[model samples]
Target: MEDPKRLEEGLGHENKDRNEQFSEKDDKTKGGDGINHEKEETNTVVVVEQKGDHKQLQQQPLVKQKTKRVATLDAFRGLTVALMILVDNAGEAYPRIDHSPWNGCTLADFVMPFFLFIVGVAIALAFKRIPKKRDAVKKIIIRTLKLLFWGILLQGGYSHAPGDLSYGVNMKFIRWCGILQRIALVYMFVALIETLIIKQRQSVVEPNHFTVFTAYQWQWIGGFVAFLIYMITTYALYVPDWSFDVYSHHKLERYMVKCGMRGHLGPACNAVGYVDREVWGINHLYQSPVWSRLKACTLSSPGSGPLREDAPSWCRAPFEPEGLLSTISAILSGTIGVHYGHVLIHFKDHSERLKQWVSMGFGLLIIAIILHFTDAIPINKQLYSFSYVCFTAGAAGIVFSGFYLLIDVWGLRTPFLFLEWIGMNAMLVYVMAAQGIFEGFINGWYYKSPDNTLVYWIQEHVFIKVWHSERLGTLLYVIFAQITFWAVVAGILHRLGIYWKL
Candidate 1:
């Protein structure tokens, strides 16, 4: 029998095992009257041999059993992680793919929601059969705590900038929220909701257009409730004028901005920033936001350059991208992911699952377009707007369904096998690659000057000189050097059965 304790990785954890009893009859004419039957749990194949033939049985070779898993899920996760590394490393040279300054969506914007959506899907698969609710909830809490701990240690101003050699962070100005922190919050709430409403998941399959919604109605209701909370608070909350201190040219400067608005969605007067400032403290928020690259804030519109001489007071105020009020809408993204995951679980046929996913995906996209075109709620990633949730979640559904069609149904997993390796060990890739830990370590060994390092040399000489274009060179280096390198690293780890789980 294969080892029951096999490792299956994702954004979080996903493990499944089933036990059943069965009997198999073999031919009784193999030079013996009786049969030597071997049976195991979970629909394993039975190998029959001669009852009194020890020498013949000893000559048999070992056979390995493969674990059942959704190959599309791992491939999708790997694609997302690979995108994260691309944007994080190459966004400086390529501004269009980077995060949008304020009001629109970009390639970088999809990474966060993709992660949250993956968490929701993973939760559906992970909690498919929870015999003990108490133990499951305990595990969820522990995983959430672990995510929060790593989020703070890695992203909470504890480490220096990628270029800076210094270490340590000021306790007063350490950020309290980040990418992993947001993921933790979304995971905890969504997992608890799914656990409480586990009874709603239908046991029998109903292959209808609306069966997915009907089966998990409570989850949609919870998602709607969260949406309403965010909408109401964003529209009704009164944002007072705020001020913050910034150190410019070795001098402490205080700047004030006038708000006194109810529903201002500007970079400075937004309710999301107001809530984060009030709850987490201005000093504890993200100091450098992508919004600083806005034309009104800096001379450069998309690329980050010097601040404009006539920049507004809010330009200097720190704003948390993963703020508190904005997280409500993010929950809706997770809820949509749970819906797609439910489709995977309830529908056995490939066509049926794709139909459900396509229907939901198009429905969300239409709603997103209506909202954005009508100016009701423009798709804004920084705020995690309602339309943003619908747009990103819808896109995720369509993409995942496509992956299923290609990798799972069509049986073409050869090209995407590299992505599967990264997906299986996504947590390790996140820490080592996306977080720049690996690059920082490599940068530690320099020849003469502090800037003379292997990574820098490759980017400057091998990539930059080959193309004679900074942007193109940086993009290619990220694709080949970082993304491809990590894929190989993850592949090796998967081969060795090494996974760093939260």
Candidate 2:
């Protein structure tokens, strides 16, 4: 018998306990044979042996079991996490690698949604084959709390610096919600959807496609429902008295106007900002938002105002991009990942799988285009607009399809093993990144003046001097060097089997 409590390394339906069934069968046999029942329950495995003249019974301790893992899924998750580390580190130097300052999507804009999408995929991979609904719910609640706990305490959130904290500690500027917190939330809610609302079917050799819809159909239904709810909440449920026109910025005033959300409607007055402000309190939100930084929208021109005295020169307003309301659409992005996971599981034909991937990607992409062109929904990452959901989810589907084609279907996994290493220990690296432990380690190797570290010297001599622009060269060096640095770190951890998951 295998131990029931086993460590899961990678994603899949939490390995079904092979020993549970064996134990149950042995118990029934023991009960019929009039063997002691209480003894069987504790660290005991029954064994019957036959000698030349007599038969004997023996018991042994339970052993461990191995569960199935998906390598491609690991690749997907690793690729996303690695990129997150890359862009986050580089964004400090290169503005281009960072999120789009405002409404439009940039390379960095795709990272978060893609990460969410992978989470969705992970949920399906982890629980699709699970039959115990109660168990699924339990796992969801527990992991949600763990992630949320760390998210609140990590960097870019609470003021944990030794200098900032003294006496009672200054808690006024602490952030209430963040990236990990949002991932936890989306995972919990979406897991509930798959576990409770959409009941899992029994294992099957061939899962029948939604008979009516040739495609998996769950993807379509989930996407449409998520978007419908998001659209209605964002547009129809508008707060009033706050107009759409460009206005002013105040440290206290997140939205453009001084009237506040007595009642406001429009892009600026979306529920995403309102809920975060009311629920988390303005002080707890990110002091400077990604969108407001480098771009200014004010009373006169679109983003055409001087840096408000209340705010920093880069950004004065405290608007949480990963707000409570935005989580609504983020779930949709994750739903796309869940759909892809199902496609991987149920479909065997590589060509058919490829076709489905293409179909799903294009379908969503076209819809997003229509929404953007019609002006019915703009692709605003700040708001997590319906168009943005569609666009990003579509992009995620397409990117995953590429991985499916090159890695899973083709089985060219050797090159992607680097990413797999990172993927396997995604949470560990994520926490380290959030804590800035990676930066501290990098600094520890230097023994020169504060500004004359190995990285700085390389940037100065090899990058900035060789390249034309100081900022551009520095940016390029960070982008390349940081990703390589993190990849090596992730690789080392993976080699040591140090995969940390909740």
Candidate 3:
């Protein structure tokens, strides 16, 4: 409840006023007309109102307590942010946890889907009761724009990475798509869909098995339509030979990749890559792709290394992982999340919620397994295939339910308090830690040389030197230095009631 509360409280600047208005409405509608207000039981308390010996027993509706924020949702979201920091920071030294080279699931590959899934779940709670549709639409648009602006600002190939002490991006080659950008697109469409279609909160004493499904049938249909479009475009599009130009030793060089193929899902020739190139342009796409680490491209196989002698021309070409088609497919994750949020809104009983969540979770997993094993979809994160959505969304549901069980149901919130803190202000942590804004700022302060910053010294002397293992040291640095430090910052912010929403 705390998790959804944080979102409802922080997501929009106007939510506070909106909540107050709802409270006022509740107060005014406390008589015969308001008897069936939003799932309220018919229990009433006697009020004594007397006027000169005429004793009258007036019954007042028992006001329901405000819904507390879901600690489980906060903890679960915080866990996702933590995993993002871990994988992004430590994956370079540990390839096992890194994103899959091409068409498999890895720890790192789950991060994006997990993020999308969280957004989906949050949308359900955020739009539980939309008092003013126009205002809600305006807020959604503003937030979506903010996400887009930040995504482009932070990840638009402008800001230098940790090691580089440089600023500014080459506008000509600035990447237009990234992790946040994809999230922005998904959030915009999903939030709009929910805002446009959601009915007013209705009282349901005992919602049948298909109540949630029936309520959100349009969202499901939209998801299916999007999925169908993705499938058709993926399988029917004719991909021809594509070429990209790059400067090699200050000389302009062009490389042509012969990919006159259709329905191919390899790293070289895929409909996703083709669509991105045709739409966003090759220069605007991500320069360094995970495909470069593929066995066919690199001699080192899993880790990025020198290109193999027989590497294909497409290996060097730019590819955007969070491309247009893949992002369209990603909307399904958010749709599934909305369904979970609906369950939370409708069902107050822990057992019933868990039953629905677990059932859906396992059901999605089963579909993912069937599609993957049958070689139909193959669970490709790069493509954001149908199977990938099912697998990741299912896992997200089960994991979220586990957190709900542990923290919300069982009242075990202490152990995961740090995660809850981070979840409460996830956007702040994401910008500071995951995006390396803090690192870049810290590196700005140096003694004599740019490389002599506190960040570099700590990574070299404190972590790597102590462990004598670069991989282990890198992992520990991320855990202790980045994750722990941000956790404390978020906790302080949470205590201070300071949150960076949007």
Q: Judged by TM-score, which candidate is best? A: 3
Ranked candidates (lDDT, high to low): 3, 1, 2
Off by over 4 Å in 2: 1-69, 159-169, 197-202, 205-226, 240-267, 293-315, 441-469
- Model 2, range 191-211, lDDT digits (tens) per residue? 776676544343333544443
The whole-model lDDT of each prediction reads 0.79, 0.62, 0.80
For model 3, give the 10-residue run with minimal summed lDDT: 28-37
Q: Using TM-score, rank the candidates from best to worst.
A: 3, 1, 2
Q: What are the runs in model 3 whose C-alpha is more than 4 Å off?
A: 1-46, 49-52, 56-67, 200-206
Is 1 or 2 the stronger prediction by lDDT?
A: 1
Point out the higher-scoring one by TM-score: 2 or 3. 3
Residue 264 in model 3: lDDT? 92
Task: Let me know the TM-score candidate 1 reaches against the reference structure.
Answer: 0.88
Q: Write the per-residue lDDT of candidate 1 for residues 352-384, one digit (tens) a residue.
A: 888889888989999999999899999999999
TM-scores, one per candidate: 0.88, 0.74, 0.89
